[model samples]
Target: MNFPRLQGMTEALRLTQAGQLNDATQLLQQLCQGQAATGPRDATVRPRRVIDLARALPKAIASGVVSPGPAAPRATVFNGTAARPANSPMPAGAAFHALTYSGPTGTRAYRLYVPASYRGAAVPLIVMLHGCTQSPEDFATGTGMNVLAEAEGCLVAYPAQPASANPQKCWNWFNANDQQRDQGEPAILAGLTRQIMRDYAVDARRVYVAGLSAGGAAAAILGAVYPDLYAAIGVHSGLACGAARDMPSAFAAMRQGGAAPSRAAAGQRTPPAIVFHADRDGTVHPRNGDQVLAQFGAGLGMKPERQDGQVPGGHRYTISRYRNGQGEPQLEHWLIQGGGHAWAGGHAPGSYTDPRGPDASREILRFFLQHRMA
Candidate 1:
């Protein structure tokens, strides 16, 4: 009902303009709970809309800045000089670094997670992309990836999307510029992945990429364009690659639950993939999960291993695992009944997460480690 197109954000913007950051942050934390609880008063704060508010609020809180309007900072890159809550100090078993990358694609900032057990030995590396309005730290905190990586003796990298690019800090997965192998976001992300591989003792054969929402959509694109780079891909609550090539189509696809099913011919070159989505996902249709799985295991003509169960104390889910002729998993899809447009099994601090029974993060990692680049 508001011209802003996104409700609740208006009041938060007013608070931002008033210089009441702490109050604004608190309000945002409540308004943009990212798949958190909602009631009659929150009906205006739709799940998808809340994701935007949640994402935008964090950028505002961290940067000591705010856009002139509801969009976001105009220039991507790290906000001119915003001050975000420092990420928790890296633990003894692992180290974290905030680094910047400059290339033909321009400058992009990323956070690298290096485990303490590293002594110049090759280990798996995972490139994590954040959704709209999410920072590497927020994603890391919500996913608890570093803890998993530390125990698994692997490396995890978080690439941040500068708000200036999407205004909401969402990856331009629908932008033609960002879809090609040697082009846009694909090139930049690939370059950064390679750079990390070169800088660290990384096992190039075991490199992987995963993301949430827009970030998740981008991950699927990377897998398609650069199968050699990423051994496997994890797209949580995201659509398939090429689901949309523009904004309007992007929204349409989101509503329809992804573009038409993919008809990929299963083979060695086809990068294995795992997807997660919820039945009650208001932001993204549940069928999108089916489409993702279909695309991952397009051909090869293999039957799926299906199982349905509920989290011990959380939501119920259906898991369909597909494998190639060699019995190697090519695709696995998790359909969380009564889920929303959030990362299922994710914890707090990050937006758009539903802390339900089946943990998508752990499941993604488990599926990733099962396959490697040939």
Candidate 2:
């Protein structure tokens, strides 16, 4: 098979940058066709790269910026700037792969991103969870978070929700099974954290979790049940506790087929939190977002102190930050006035996403870096 030429890939990237979606897409298809003809040795890898490019092109077009085509045919488009001007050297970081571990049902998968800063020295770890029906790779691209992690000198892990857990791949945050003591989904997630820590120099004190929608609720549960494991948490366009009662209720709540769950144990240790939501979010009620802010604010014995700020495109963001005391670092609440139930300023490549203003990924990373377990 004829492999996609390096020059063609570079040109496609240029076209994408120029907002030429059709041309970029056509080139991607041509690249895929070329991969189909490659011999067995390189055949397997090429198609994967093609798929990555295919999935990313639409988003690049949506964002009005040309995308860097996939580095590997079948793999994600990380470090695609590999062929760019050598002036800006690539940072040294271990390229992570999908790793599987056991959960209640069967095997679960997650992707890890470690920066060059992650030498033998302990470094902060951030777990970025995806919303319903999303994969780790999808979240990684849609959120553009790995770049932030690289900039911040941290390790990023994306926990995946398998279809077996929920048809929509929503984490069972609303389920009693997922939130229980030591033997449920919480354990499984924490186990993954431990495994990553053991395999890498993870700074226990600086561990954090952030998620969107269903994944956000799961991050809340992680901070609640395993406070010692995660120092901080971020929830975007998600509900506060009391979104469900049991597994059945959880399922119903997720499908929007039932009411919110009853409030569970508030848990003793409260990890500092940052919440992001759009006042106009149609899918997840903005009220749910308020409840989340209220819960964490109250935990710190305070209320949200509002500040005014303007984001790109002159979009105004109401920042409600809370703190425990004088010495405590503040937690932020961003109520994007006209934003939707999506990552703020994210490309609209998938459903349940809003591209209104500030980048949630960058804000979440900044929030994670501020606080640690006391």
Candidate 3:
């Protein structure tokens, strides 16, 4: 481990635990800049929103009403270096509601998105998990999934990871308690899915989960432990399940993709998955994406078809597809060339999205719609 960098991250975690969220985020931003991480180390940096959250965090902390969710040590480690687009108009057409979900593990708040055109018909449901320091609105804006939801008539859910649960607002994918069946975050997320399905006319078989970075790792965990719930999984720049159990190993996985986590016998069932990763991602090594397909695709007993292509005026990419005996693709891995740690083919309205590559949102949904819960 890079001791100096680790020390900085550790201090950031302490700041978050002490309710100094803005300072922690600012310090994290400073550390993200290569040259800044080398210089006066104490350089004060303030991200506009973190400062705003700092004002409200105290109130939430004092009231004791904040949901105990999950958090990360630093946002930059998961969010990347993309700038939030200026004058980007807020998206509409999807009516959103703030709701809460309680399961065997715990309770957490979430936002539900219903298309304006919906009446009373069964539609697909998408459970989107945001990165650290992000909310439903941010993730919605960034991924443009809501806009697609409006067009496609699918329900969308954005689960919040409160500071009380995770000081960094990241899903606790690194915690052992959160990595299993009917336990921890996985249980809570699954419960949230079932709740949404019950409250709305959601097609149980079409339910899917997707997330970025830390959320992506948690998505993998969900697909692994609760394959029956999520028909398909989308992981954008995320690690494989059981990649790490703590900060040390998590950091190791981020730096140099760790060994594939243990899994059940090959005869068992698992959810089909789609992955997006940029070869030039600086935060999470691109090798982790390779590990994702390798880990899950291991037991498939077949070779994946490899194809290469390029997007006009954007990034080049390679697609690796694994197939079942019927020749249907079970896994799709997109390796974007020259892509950083941002959503490929995402709009500028949201953060950490690269609009240069193929549209991941559309492709993932297309891939997801091909599979359903058995």
lDDT score for candidate 2 against the true structure: 0.64
Q: What is the lDDT for 168 in model 2?
A: 63
Which residue segments of model 2 deviate by more than 4 Å?
A: 1-93, 103-106, 246-267, 348-352
RMSD of each: 10.3, 13.8, 8.6
TM-score of each: 0.77, 0.69, 0.77
Better of 1 and 3 by lDDT: 3
lDDT of 3 at 212: 87
lDDT tens readout by residue for model 2, 1-374: 32346666666665544445445556666666764322223212222111111122233332222222212111121211111111233366556567877755346689998776666788998988888768887787667677677777788899888777676677766666776657567888888888888988888899999888888887877876777889989988776665665554443333232353333246566678898877655445566666666555554467667898765442468887776777475568888776555666554443344444566777788888888777
- The TM-score obtained by model 1 is 0.77
Q: What is the lDDT of residue 98 in candidate 3?
A: 92
Query: Worst 10-residue stretch by lDDT in candidate 3?
Result: 64-73
Candidate 3 clashes between residue pairs 3 or more apart in a chain or in different chains: 69-165, 70-166, 71-166, 71-169, 71-170, 72-170, 142-350
lDDT of 3 by residue, 1-374 (tens): 67777776766655555545445555666777732334233435332222111222323222111111111112211123242342344355447899999876889999888988778798999999987778777888877787677778888899999888887688888788899888888989998899888888988889999998888988999988887788899999888988888655665676678667666457767788899988776556788887777666645586878898876666678998888777767889999888766777766666666666577887887888788877
lDDT of each: 0.71, 0.64, 0.73
